[model samples]
Target: MTSRALVVLFKELREALRDKRALSLLALFVVMYPAIIGFTLNRIIDKAGSPEREGIQLTVVGSEYAPTLMAQLKQKNVIVTPHAPLDEQATTDLLRTAKTVAVLKIDAKFVENYAAMRPARVELWYDSAIDNGRKIDEVENVLREYTSRIAQARLLAHGVSPVTLVPVTVQKYDTGTSASRSAMIIGAMLGSFFIPAFIFCLSTAVDTTAGERERRSLEVLMAQPVSPAQLVFGKLGAATVLSAVGLTLELVIAHAILKWLPLEEIGLSWRLTTADLTFAILASLPLCLFAAAFEIALAMNAKSFKEAQSTLSFAILVPMLPLILIPMLDLQTATWMYAVPVLSNMTLLRELSKGADIGLLHYTLTAAGSLVVALLCYAFAAVRMKSEKYVLAV
Candidate 1:
C-alpha cells in the first residue's frame, strides 16, 4: 500500500510540474506578494523618517500685527508665507491643494484687543481631510507657548505673580515601544500570508480530481490494484506537498525582505532571527496540508473543474473568517485561539513577531488542530471513493 501510494504521489507531482500554467501561478505568488509588501513598507519608512519641519509651509494673512508671534513661528523652523487676507472660500481652496499644511488667520482686531487688555482671537484654519495631524499639532503647540508667554508678561506688569494663574502641572509618559506598534501593523498583514496556502494548490487539487474525471480517466485509474485509501492519500499528499513548498518559499522571501529593510526608521522592528523563521515555517506546514486535503475532498465530488473551482473558492472563506474578524474584536490572545485553524497560525506568527515567549504547548495545539482536520477530510474522501455511487458517477 505504501509503495502504491508513493507511486501515485510521484505521478501526480510530475504531471503538476509539467503543467506550465500551474508552475507559473505558483512562481507569481512566491515573488509578487513579498516584493509588493517590501516596497510599500520601505516607502512608509522613508516618509516617516523625514524631518518634521522639512517641507512645512504655513500661510499667514496678517503677520504685522504680531511680530513676536511671527518670530516664534520662524524660530520653530516653520516657513511662514505672508499673503493678502483670504476669505473662507479661498482658505478652503488653498487647503484642498495640499500645498500648505495649514493657514493662520490673525484677527484684524488683534493689536487693538491686546492694547485694551481684552481676550484676542486667532483662527487656525486646517483641512481635516488631510493626514497632516502631526504637523498641525506642532503648529498648535507653538501658538500655545506664545500665548502663555504673553499672559505671563501681562501678569508681571500688573505686579502680580505669574504663578498665581497656574494650579497644577501634568507630565505624560508612554510605555508602548515602536516594536509593539510595528507588531500591530504586521499582525494585520500576517493573516493574509496563510491565504496563499489554499490558493497555490487550488489548480492542482481541482485538476487531479474533477479534471481527471471530466477527461474520463478516473475510472481507468480506479481499476488498478491500489485501494481507495491509497489513491486518496497519494493525491492529497501531492497537493499538500505543493502547498507546503509554495508557502515555505513565501515565508523565506518575506523574512529576507523584512530583515533587510530598515524597519527601525519608522518605529517598527522585525526581530525574527533565521532560526525563529525556520521554526515558524515548520509550524505552519500543517495548515497547508489541511487546506489541500479540504479542497481535494470537495473537488472530488464535483462533476467538472469549473464547478469545483467555484465551490472551493467560496469554501476557502470559512478558514479566513477568524483571520478577518478576530482582530476587529480586539480580543486578548487566549488558549482557545490556538485551537482554531488559520487563526491559530496567524496568532502564532503575531505572537512570535512581538517577541513573546509563548510556550511549546501553543505550537503543539496549532499543528495538532490542523492535522486532525486534514485526516478527517482525507478519510471522508477515501470513503466516498469506495462507494458504489461514486464509482458509477465516475
Candidate 2:
C-alpha cells in the first residue's frame, strides 16, 4: 500500500515539475517576496540614518536682531540660512519646498522688548504636513535655553534670585528601547510571509484533482488497485511536499536578505540564527500540509480547473483571516494563539524575531495544531473520494 502511494506521489510530482507555468509561479514567489521586503527595509534604513550625516537646515528671517540666539542655534548643529524679512505667503512657499526644517522669525521689536525686559516673541514657521517633528523640537529646545539664560542674567543684574521665577520643575525619561519601538513594524511584516504557503500549492492541488477530473481521467485512476485512502494520500503528499519545499526556500532566502541588511540602524532586529530559522521552518511544515490538504479537498469538488482555481482562491482567505485580523486587533500573544494554525505560526515567528525565549511547548502546540487540522482535512477528502456520489460524478 505504501509503495502504491509512493508511486502516485512520484507521478504527480513529475507532472507538476514538467508543467513550466506551475514551476514559474513557484519560483517567482520564492524570489520576489524576499527581494521586495529587503529593498523596502533597506530604503527605510537609509532614510532614518541620513539626518545625522546631513545637519538640520534652519531659515532665520531676523538673524541680525538676535545674533546671540543665532549663534546658539549654529552651535547645536543647525545650518542657519539668514533671509530678509518675508511675508506669510513667501514663508509658506519656502516651507512647501521642504528644503529647511523650519523658519525662525524674530519679532521686529525684539531688541526694544529685550531692552525693556518685556517678553519677546518668535514665530516658528514649518509645514505641519511634513514629518520633521524631531527637528522642530530640537530648534525649540535651543530657543528655550537661550531665553532661560537671558532671564537668569537679568535677575542677577536686578539682585533678585532666578530661583524665585520657577515654582516647579519637570523632567522626562523614556524607557522604551529602539528594538521595542521597531517591533510593531516588523511584526506586521512577519505575518505576511506565511501567506505564500497557500499560494504556491494552488496550481499543483488544482491540477491534480480538478484538472484530472476535467480531462476524464479521474475514473481511470480510481479504478486502480490502490485504496481510496492511499490515492488521496499520494495526491496530498505531492502538493504538501512541494508547498513545504517552496516555503522553506522562501524562508531561507528571506532570512539571508534580512541578515545581510543592517536593520540595527533603524532600531529593528532580526535575531533569528540558523538554528532558530531551522526551528521556525520545522514548526511551519504542518501549516504547509494543512494548506495543501484543505485546497485539495476544495478543488476536488469543482467540475473544471478554472472553477477549482476560483473556489480555492477564495478558500485561501480562511487561513489568512487570522494572520490579518489578529495583528490589526493589536492583541498580545497568548497560549490560545498557539492553537490557531496560520496565526500561531505567525505569532511564533514574530516572537522569535523579537528575540523572545518562547519555550518548546508553544512550538509543539503550533506544529501539532496544524498537523491535527491537516489530518482531518485529509481524512474527509479520503472518505469523500470513496463515496458512491463522488464515483458517479467522476
Candidate 3:
C-alpha cells in the first residue's frame, strides 16, 4: 500500500512538473500572489498609520463646557466652530448642511452637575448617512474617553481612590499560546484571499483532469494498466502540489515584505517564526485537499468542461460567504471557532500572525478532519467513475 501511494505520488509530481499549463500557473502565483498580498497589506497599514488630519469642523452649540472641550479638540487638530442655539434643531440643521462634521450640545445642567459630582449628559449630532457608521463611533469614543478621565480626576481630588471606584482590573488569560492569536488574525486575512484562489484553481485543475476524462482522454490513460483510483489520486496529488508551491511562494514573499515593513510603528508586529509558518501550512493543507477532492468530483460529475468550471466557481461562494461576514462582525478566534472547517483555518491563520500558540488538539483535529474529508471525496469519485452510466454521461 505504501509503495503504491508513493509511486502514484511520484508519477503525479513528475507529470505536474512537465505540464506546461501547470508550470505556468504555479509560476504566475509565485510572482503575482505575493506581490498582490504585500501591496494590499502595505496599503492597509498606510491608511491606518496616516497622521494627516481630516480638518473636520466641529460646531458646538450651548455647552458650558465649550471652552475646555474646544481647546482639547484644537489640541487634537480638529477645527472647532461655535454655533448659535446649541439646541437639537439647530444642531440637526448644521449637520444636514455639512457645516459641521460633528455638533456638541452640553446639557443645561452641565455646570451644576459637575459641581455636584453627578453624571452629566452630553449630546453629539452627526450625519449618519455619510461614510457609514464608523465616523460617528470614532467621535463618540473620543467623547467617552475624555469624559471618563475627567470624572476619574474629580473623584481622585475628593479623597476617593480611582481604584476604589473600579477595583477589579479585568485581564483576559488565554490558555492558548501566542501563536494562536497571531494565527487567528493572519489566518482570517490570508484565508479571505487564498481560499478563493484555491477554489478557482480546483475548478481549472479538474477541467484539466476529469473534464479530459469526459472528453475520452482520461479513459485512454486509465486503460493503460493503472487502476482508476490510482489515476484519480494522481490527478488530485498533482493539484495539491501545484497549490502548495504557489502558496509557499506567496508566504515567503509576504514574510520578507512584512519583516521590513515597520509594522511596529502602528502597534503591530507582523513577524512570523519558522513554527508559525509550519502551522500556517498545516492549517492550509486541509483546505487544499478538500479543494482538490471536491473539484475532482464536480468535474467528474459535470457533463462538459463549461459545466465543471461553473460548478467549481459556485463552490467558492460558500467559503467566500464566511470570509465576507467574519471580518465585518469582527469575530475573534476561540476554541469553538477552530472546529469550523474553513473558518478554523482562517482563525488559526490570524492567531498565528499575532504570535499566538495554536493548541495541539485544534491543529491535529483540523488536519485530520480535512484529510478524512479529502479521502472520502476521492473514494466517492472513484466509486462513481466505476458506473458505466456515469462514465458515459459526459
Best by lDDT: 2
- What are the lDDT figures for the candidates, one per model? 0.86, 0.87, 0.67
Model 1, global lDDT:
0.86
* Candidate 2: 10-residue stretch with minimal lDDT: 175-184
Candidate 3 runs further than 4 Å off: 1-22, 30-33, 44-188, 196-204, 328-332
Global lDDT for candidate 2?
0.87
Expressed as tens digits, the lDDT of each residue in 1-394 for candidate 3 is 4456556667656756666775676666666755776676677566554423365567776644646766666666566676566556766676788656777777778878877888777777788775424445556666776787897898788888778877688999767543444355345557654564464356346655556666787666656666667767777776777676666666676677767776554455666777777777767777777777877777778777777777777876766776788879987666877766677676666666766666787787667756777888899888876776665663
Model 1 C-alpha lDDT per residue in residues 189-298, reported as the tens digit of each score: 88777888888888889888888877867788899999999988889889999999999999899889998999987788988778778778888999988999999999
lDDT minimum window of 10 residues, candidate 3: 177-186
Candidate 1 pairs with clashing backbones: none
TM-score, every prediction: 0.91, 0.89, 0.63
Pairs that clash in candidate 2: none
Model 3: what TM-score? 0.63
Higher-ranked by TM-score: 2 or 3: 2
Across 1-394, the per-residue lDDT of candidate 2 in tens digits comes to 9999999999999999999998999999898878888989998887776656677899999889999998898888889999999899999999999999999999989999999999888999999899887778889899899989998999899999999988898888977655555556877777778888988899989888888877767788888998999989999999998889999999999999988999888877676789988999999999999999999988877766898889997987876798668757978889989989888998888778777787999899999999999999999889888886665554
lDDT of 3 at 4: 60
Give the best candidate by TM-score. Answer: 1
